[model samples]
Target: MFEKILIANRGEIACRIIRTAKQLGIATVAVYSDADANSQHVKQADEAIYIGESPASQSYLQMDRIIQAALDTGAQAIHPGYGFLSENDQFALACEKNNIVFIGPPVAAILAMGLKATSKALMEKAGVPLTPGYHGTNQDADFLKQQADGIGYPVLIKASAGGGGKGMRLVERGADFLGALSSCKNEAKSSFGNDEVLVERYVMNPRHIEVQVFGDSHGNYVHLFERDCSVQRRHQKVLEEAPAPQMAEAKLEVMRQAAIDAARAVNYVGAGTVEFIVEQDGTSYFMEMNTRLQVEHPVTEMITGQDLVEWQLRVAFGEPLPKLQHELHIHGHAIEARVYAEEPEKGYLPAIGKISYLHYPEQNQNVRVDSGIVDGDEITTYYDPMIAKLIVWGKNREAALVQMHHALGHFHVEGLGNNIAFLDRIIRCDSFKHARLDTNLIQREDEFLFKNIQKANAQLIISAAFTALLSLFKQNITANNPVWQAESLWRLNISNSYPIKFKLDDENILVNFSPVEHGFIAEYQGQNYQVSGTLIDQNSIHIEIDGKKDKLAFSQNETALTLFSNAQNFKFAYIRPDFNTDDSDSNDHNLKAPMPGVITKVLVSANDHVKKDDVLLTLEAMKIEYSIRAPQDGIIAAAYFQVGDQVKAGDELVEFQVLAEDVA
Candidate 1:
C-alpha cells in the first residue's frame, strides 16, 4: 500500500476517500479551491493545498495544478473521486506519465469506455447486448436527425462523454429532433468539452440497474451483485437500492456475468459500474459504463460489507482481487437517498445559499451519513448541491424502506430550498413501497410527490407561537433582563394578552396569547387553544397544545423560524408590527433570472419581437442549463446582460414591451 496519497477532488467523495485511506494507515492530502477552503474535506485531510479559484475550470479541472499539488505533498498516488477528473482519460494518462499511481482504471480502459459511442461499439463486438441506436462519430446535425428518424420517435440524444444525467435530451417527435440535438450538443460541449453525441432509442418504462465489477493488476475479477437506480428526477437518480428487489436469481446471475465480460473486454482494473436499462419484461440492454466509483456506491457497500474505496486502493497497489466471484455474497438489503439542496416543487431548481441550520438523523450501524458539510456551510452555485447521502440497511427490502422513511423524516434544513420532504414522500408513497419503480417514477407519481403546499394548521400555528415566545424568553434571561423572570412575576400573577405575528409564505398570521401557569392560552381565527412548550435545546421543543403533547424540531434564523413536523417543514418569518411589504416589481415588464447563474446564450436582441414561450436566453448553473423564455408576445426593450455575464437571482435579464390585445 502507498504510504501517502492525495485526493484530487473535493466535497463528500474526497472526504470519503480520506477516511478509507486513514484506516489503511495512508496519509491523505486534500486539494481545495477558494470556495472549499473551510470545507470538511480540507479539515479532515492530513494536509491541504490551495489549487485555484472557486470555479471548476479554474481549480478542480486544472490538471497541472492538481498534479503539482500531489507531487509537492509527496503523494505517491492520486484518487480522482468520481467527478471533475475521475473519468478523464487524459488525466489518467497524465498520472501514468508522471509515474504517480492513479487509483483508477488504466488509460487504455478509460479511453475505450469513456465515450458512449466507443463503448457501445466495443460492447457490440464483445457480444454484450446493446440498445438499438446510432453510435457513429458523425457530428453532422442533419445526419443525426436522419438516424433519429430511422430509430423512430422518442429517441434519446446523449453526450458521448456525459454522466450524472448531463448533456442528455429525450425527443418524442421527429420535428423536435434537430432542436433537441442542438441543445444536447451545447450542453455536452459545456460539460465535457466534447460536442460529440449518440442517438439511441429511448426505452420506455425502464428500470436502471447497474452491476458493480472490480478487477486487479493480476487479471482477476469479481462481481459485487447489483444496484437498482430506477427512481430518478430529470434523468438523475434520487434513490437507489442494492440487491435489487424483484429480480430473479437466474436473471441476476446472467447480468452479473455480462458485467464481468464487459470489464474483461476493456481489461478493466479497479472499481467500475456496468449500467443496463431493464425493460418491464426483464430484458436488459447495455446503456453505458462508468469508469470510476459511483455516487451511490454506498448502497452496494452496505449490502456486500465491502469498502470499495479500499478495493480501489488495493488494486491500484497491484494487489490481486480481494475475493473471487463465488466467495462474495450479499448480506442485507440497503437503500440510499441523495439529499440535495433543491426545491422539488419548483422544477428541482438547484438552491444556492448559506445553510443556516442543518440537522440529520443520528448515525449508527444501521443508518449512515456520508457528508462533507457541517453547520454554517454554504451551498454555492459552484458545485453539485448534494448535501449528503442517507443510507440505511435492514434484513429485507420492506424493512429497509421503513428505515429510509423514518430517517428522512428526521432530516431537516433551513436557509435554502431542500428536497427532504420530497424524499420522505417518495419512501412513504405507495409506488415506492411496492417497488413499482422506473426512470419516470417522479413524473408518474407527481400528484403525490408534489402535493399542494399546506397552510399552517392549528397545531403548527400554536407550535410556532409558543416556540417564538420561549425563544424570546430565553434571550431575555440570557441577557440578564430583570423585568423577565421564570416565575411569571413580570405579569404580577395576572395573565395579560400579547399579540404575535408571523409571515408564512407571503400570508400573514396573527395569534393572541395569555401567559398561563404551565403554558399559554392562544386564540387564532376565533379558536382558543392551550399552548405551552419548553425549549429542549436550541432546535427542539416539547409542547402541549389543547391537552395533546408532542416534541417537535425547529430552527430559527435571523429572518425566519422553521418548524419540522409531519415530515414537512413550515417556515415563518417574524412580522413586526411596523413591517411593510415590497411589491415594487409586481407590474415590472421585465424577465429576471430565477437563480444565480452565468449567461450562456442570448437568443434575443434589444427591440426584437418574440412570441410567448419563445426561447429568449439560456443560463448555466451547477452544471445544468435552463432556458429563459418570453412570457408573452412582446418586443424586447433591452437585453441587460450578454453571454458569459454572471447574474444573481432576481437580476433583470431582459425588458419587454407587450403588444396590445387588439394589435394584429
Candidate 2:
C-alpha cells in the first residue's frame, strides 16, 4: 500500500477518506481553501496545505495547486473524493504524468462517461438498456425541439456535462420547449462550460437505484448490491437506503448485471457507481455511471460490511479484487439521511452561520454519524451545505426506519435553519412508509411535507414565556448578585391575567401562567397544571410538569422552541404579538436575497414594468440556482446588483415603486 495519499477534496468526504487511510496506516494530506481553513476535515488530516482562495475554481478545482500540494507532501497517490475534481479527466491524467496514482477510475473511463450524450451512446452500443431520446451531436434548437416532439410530451433536456440537476429542464409541452431549452443551455454553459444537451424520455414514476461496483488493477471486479435513492428534492437525493424495499430478486439481478456491464464497458477500475432509473413495472434503464465514490456510499457500506475507501486504496496499490461477487451478501437494511443546513419552508435555500450549539445523538451498535463539522464551525456559502450523513442499520427496513427517526429527533443543531423537521415528516409519512416513492415524491407532496407545525401548540407559548422569564431572571440575579449560587432562591409574581396565544398552521392555543412554589402554575383550555424547571443552559430548560416522571428537555430561541422527550421532538413557537391593532404599518417594499449567493443575472432594469411573479433576478448558491420574482405588479425603482455580485440574506437587490392605489 502507498505510505501517504493526498485527499484532493474537503468537507465530509475528505474526512471520510482520511479515516479509512488512517485505518490502513497510510498518512493523509488535506487540501483546503481559505473558507475551509478551520473545517473539521483539515484538523483530522496528518498534514494540511492551503491551495487557494474561497472560490472553488481558484482552489479545489485548481489542478496545478492540488498536484503540487500532493507532490510537496510526498504523497504517492491522490484521492479525489467526489465533486470538484473527482471526475475531471485532466486531473487524473496529471497524476499519471506526475507518477502519482489516482485513487479512482482510469482517465479513459472518466473521458468515456464524462458527457451524458456520449455515455448514452456508449451504453447503447454496449447493449445496455437506455431511455429513448435524442443523442445527436447537432446543437440546433429547432432540431432539438423536433426530437422532443418525436419523443412525445414530458421529455427531459439535460446538459451533456455535470449533474446535480444543473442545466436540466423538464418540458411538458412543445410550445414551452424552446424557452426552457434556452434557459437550460444557458445554465449548463455557465455551470459546466458545455452547452451541448440531450433529450430523453422522462420516466413518469422513476426509482433511482444504483449498484456499487469495484474493480482492481488485475482486471477483477465485484458488485456490492445496490442502494435505493428515490427520495429526492429538486432532483437531488435527500435519503437513501440499501436493498431497496419491495424489490424482487429477479429485478435485483437484472440491475446488478446491467451495472456490471456498464462498468466493464468502460474498462472501469476502482470504486464507481452505475445508477439506473427503474420504472414502477420493475423495468430499469441505465442513467449514468459516476466515476468516483458517491455521497451515499455509506448506505452500501453498512449493508455489505465493506469499506469502499479502503477498497479504493487497495485497488490503487494494484491489488486484486478482495472478494468474489458470490461472497458478498446483503447483511441488513440500512438507511441514511443527509442532514443539510437549509430551510425546507423557505424553498430549501442554503443556510449559513455559526453552529452555536451542536449535539450528535449517542451512537450505538446500529447507529452511525459521519460528520465534517463541529459546534463552533461556521457553515458558509462557499461549499456544499451538507452537514452530515446520519445512517442507521437494523434487521429489517421498519426497524431501521424507526431507529433513524429516533436518531433524527435526538440530533440537535442551532444557529441556522435546517431540514431535520422536514426529514422527520418525510419518514413519518404514509406514502414513504409504504415505499410508494418516485423521483417526484417531494414535489408531489411538497405542501404536506414543508408545512410548519411548531406554531400550533399551546406548550410552545408556555415554553417561550418560561424561556423569557428565565432570561430576565438570569440577568436580574447576575446584575444584583454577582456571586449568586446555582441553588440560590428566587421568586417571581404575575402582574395581569393575560392570555398567551400560539398559532401553528391554522390552529390556535391559548395558555395562562402564574407564579407558584419553586416554579409556576399554568392552565390551557380546561386543564390546570404545575410546571417547574431550572435553566440548565442558555438554550435548554429542564422542566417537570404535573409530577411527570420523565424530565422534559425544552429548547427555546426567538422564533421557536422544541420540547424533546422519549427520542421524539415536538416543536413550538411563540405567538406573534398582535401589533397591527395599535401600531401603524410601514410601507417600504424591497426585494432581498433569500440566502448568501452570487447574483447570476438581473432580469429587469430600473423603471422597467413588471407583473406579479415576473422574474427579477437569479441567485446561485451551493451549486443551485434560484430565480427571485416580483411580489406584486410594480415598476422597478432601482437595481442594486449586477451579475457576479455576492450578497447575503436580506440584502436588498431591487426596489419597486408601488402605485398609490396598490399600497395598503
Candidate 2: stretches off by over 4 Å: 452-456, 460-520, 523-527, 533-542, 554-587, 660-664
| Best prediction by TM-score | 1
lDDT of 2: 0.83
lDDT of 2 at 657: 80
Per-model TM-score versus the true fold: 0.96, 0.91
lDDT of 2 at 439: 85
Model 2, span 1-664: residue lDDT tens: 9999999999889999999888989999999999999888899999999999998998999999999999999999999999999999999999999999999999999999999889988999888899889987898999999999999989999999959768889999999999999999999999888999999999998999999998887877788999999999888899999988888889989989888888888999999999999998789999889999999999888988889898889888998878889899998899999999998888887889987667787787689999898887898888889888999999999999999988987788777878887888888777788898788888767666865344334454465555555554563222233212322433235263335555544556666766544456778878777766666677566555676523345555666666664333455556786666743453357878888899999999989999888999999999888999988888999999999999988898898887666776
Error of 2 at 201 (Å): 1.0
lDDT of 1 at 599: 98
Q: Where does candidate 2 have its weakest 10-residue lDDT segment?
A: 475-484
Q: Write the per-residue lDDT of candidate 1 for residues 311-425, one digit (tens) a residue.
A: 9999999989888888888888999999999988988899999998889899998899999988899999999999999999999998898888888878888889899888888
lDDT of every predicted structure (CA atoms): 0.89, 0.83
